[model samples]
Target: MLTDRTDTRAKLWRTASVQRGYFTAAQAKDAGYSYQAQRYHTQHGNWLQVDRAIYRFREFVDLPAEGDEQLVRWSLWSKGRAAVSHATALTMHDLGTASPSRIHMTVPRNFRQQTDALILHRAELTEGDVEERVGYRVTTPLRALVECAAVGEDQNALDIAIAKALSQGLVTQPKLLYAAQQVGPRAELGVERALAAAS
Candidate 1:
């Protein structure tokens, strides 16, 4: 019986080592560790809990190195309503020079979170608001620029986003004007300028 238990532990360790950093409880269970065994492994220093049902190996692994930490965090934070946007969307579009302090995502009206790292906004997003970019589902560059123009209090940021979209030829003048009209007068100049440049 002791040998059998040891074999299970060894198997779990080998499965975890290959993953290197993180695994969910479901994943651990799928890898052959029973719930009680998984708990025992945690108590014995084999796994560390990062969040509810999320586990990582005991040794520290580089979260940034994997390039999917944000995805993992997003998955944990309710994947349905969250879509990367604003300056983070700019970064994803490779159109601007700003580094957003936190992951900028928009959630539905009812979503909430405990951390400030997630800037949750209550908004309605349709299929039109989302697009595939660099293999990830994100707000389209044109849509994100318009969104920034509409909601961003910083005129400079709005101008930059509009300019970038225009310079890249992603939005035409008529479309820009139409979008600005939808947002109101505050966004008119930036949208007009972007449209002119795109023409």
Candidate 2:
């Protein structure tokens, strides 16, 4: 039989793998790590305390995080239910000039993580609307544009993004139209207007 320590290590390892080597105190507790033990591990160099109640396996601590490290930590912060969206996603997909002051993410309507660093929107995204990245998720170009337009992202910027996406095949015209129609009148109007200007 595995010792208690071995069993706990295995459980935490499994949890961290899906989270890009990061795990929360709650998760550690659920995996049989008591609060005191968590402190001990951190003190002993077994786990890196990354943020408030957040820990990372030293193995996956360093990464290509220069621009994206925080994205992973925040993804873990959301417990893995958020996808980079809105202006942040548009920037990631290289579709728009939406350099918002804050990062953006889409979570379930009930997900209420409040922080000044992020702008959280609520929506149920279809699988096709999200693209999985190294340690986080982001909205597809088509979805990002529709979302930005629905929220009244600047018209000229949306137009530029739409034109760029279409030219580079990041989003097809028909697909953009269908997605816009699904969003509502504003999105549909924005997409149609952009398409007309482009064509």
Q: Would you list the C-alpha lDDT of every candidate in the order shown? A: 0.65, 0.87
lDDT (tens digit, per residue) of candidate 1 on 83-192:
88766777777765676777777777787665666766557778988875322356777767766666643566656666766777877666767866876775676566
- What TM-score, computed on C-alpha atoms, does each candidate reach? 0.66, 0.82
Worst 10 residues of 2 by lDDT: 61-70
lDDT of 2 by residue, 159-190 (tens): 89999998898888999999999999998998
Q: Which numbered prediction scores highest in lDDT against the true structure?
A: 2
Cα shift from native, residue 162, model 2 (Å): 1.0
Clash count list over all predictions:
1, 0
TM-score, cand. 2: 0.82
Candidate 2 segments exceeding 4 Å error: 1-20, 26-32, 44-46, 58-66
User: What lDDT does candidate 2 reach at residue 46?
Assistant: 87
